[model samples]
Target: MNAHHPPGQTAPQDRPARLTVGVVGAGRVGPVLAASLALAGHRPVAVSAVSDASLRRAAEILPGVPVVPPAEVLARAELVLLTVPDDVLPGLVAGLAETGAVRPGRILVHTSGRHGAAVLDPATRAGALPLALHPAMTFTGTSVDVQRLAGCSFGVTAPEELRLAAEALVIEMGGEPEWIDESARPLYHAALAIGANHLVTLVAQAMELLGTAGVAHPARMLGPLLGAALDNALRSGDAALTGPVARGDAGTVAAHVAQLRAHAPQAVAGYLAMARTTADRALASGLLKPGLAEDLLGVLSDTANAASATDPADASEGPEATDDGADGGDL
Candidate 1:
């Protein structure tokens, strides 16, 4: 029971009382999160930073906090923030538990979108409170990330008994708490990765293609166009889609595929894949008629087959194209 509130009463509305916080990983995320917690009135006591970049980030974000080993950080902090990579988290927690570093009643939180509170079972077994609090925004290991936390949502997973405490901590860090079921953690993380990480790859590919087209300032040319496209997509979903594929312009799409195959062979596969998917989605969303979709699909199929026959090596690299027809379409 919290000392400040009676057993039957609800917890206070204001920020929770200050507690000594320690960070186990001073990577891009840890330092920024620790800085945010410090800004929320928590006392940052110790942090573990192995790399030179991590050390610099810690010095910049968590100025006075002592750099210590993970065990020492765990031993001294009332709340421990484990911000290591997802693959390393379970083993780290188990190793700390084996060494008796985690104490009873200490709050152990991990920042992995791929996992929920279940990944902290080792800490829980050591009698610590396990919580998963993954901030939805990307981190930069800079003060800018702290400000980004203001309107961000945190994917929180905890035992029913500790839900309020978990939410309180996220709220204090200037984030909204979104409860995520343990079973759905992987899918939830996959959605974020596809939306954010894949968007970066797509943008890079676009800029490279623009450079190939002799655009001196590709970003400046794409900025407003891409921004408006993103806004429309968000506001109207597939209904906002407007491109050669969406418009059922089979001839244009065939031309695009031929150009990509000849000059940007590596990008041909992605272009075909996205075009096929877009056609399917547009048809499903009533944005394109079934007859038009058939025409687009036929063009895509013939272009893919032509590309495959032109270079068997390219055919073996990406998704297999179904044999529909030869590449001699003007439709």
Candidate 2:
């Protein structure tokens, strides 16, 4: 029995008991996950790493493990981790299966948030046991990721018969497993991309605007405000929203549009789009009064129309034109 087995759960003698692991991709996520499995007593047999950084990380995390070709890795491993990019995964699986690399009774797992186990159907036909185990946390290709695995949630998708094994593997890696239907994987991934990836973009935009406004340290300026806003949004959802738009301050919003157009034209579209969406959400959540919302909508519409009407060649000619008397509404 492996030394790290949990109390009261002994390996059965009748079953094949070896837990040799192979990682097919040594990218940011792959090495960390393999290290976590190693911590849970699985032996790291081989890893396929093509890039210099990946090879370096593998050396650091899986010391003394052989860097082998994909087929060799698959041949040696009882558990194979396919951690390539989402776009590259299907082709890799098909290629591996075509070359007779996949074997019966071996557990094949992928770390793509966009795909479920169904993407491994080619390998399934070759008799591999397929499972999709996507960690919800982002990776940095370092030791820190291994520590972060504890208490993290993995979005799991697998065949009914293999559910227990999949969940057990995730638990062994110090992660909780949340089952996701195969059809729902795309939407699940989209939600994470919007929440995490797009959040980075939004923060970048905020910092750029702050810099334009002469803030010497944009990170310091935004850190507390963003942290509190994120905490409140998570705790209270739309009910926690606050700002000029949420408060139905049409005049302040118009002033913002005018200033952005005058000084930072590139930010105008994104600002208006988010503002409109925020207004819609606030209105739906009953956070903004209907009459006030109408006024805010009118101001936004007028600003959008004014922006569209202005010629690109004339952009530097003067301050952006605005609808006559559109900013007359009270807050």
lDDT (C-alpha, whole model) for all candidates: 0.84, 0.87
Candidate 2, overall lDDT? 0.87
For each candidate, what TM-score against the reference?
0.88, 0.87
Q: Candidate 2: list runs displaced more than 4 Å.
A: 1-18, 308-331
Query: Over the stretch 1-331, how does candidate 2's per-residue lDDT look in tens digits?
Result: 6455566665432234548999998877877888898777688899998867778988998899999999999999999999887877899999999999999988999999989999999999999999999998877777887998999989999999999999999998899999999999999988888888778889998899899999999999999999999999999999999999999999999999999998888788888988999999999999999999999999999999988887654455776643211110000
Predicted candidate 1 versus true structure: per-residue lDDT over 95-213, tens digit per residue: 99999998999999898998899988988998999998988876667788899899788899999999999999999899999999999988988888887877887899999999998
Provide the lowest-lDDT 10-residue window in model 2: 322-331
Compared with the true structure, model 2 gives a TM-score of 0.87
RMSD of 2: 9.6
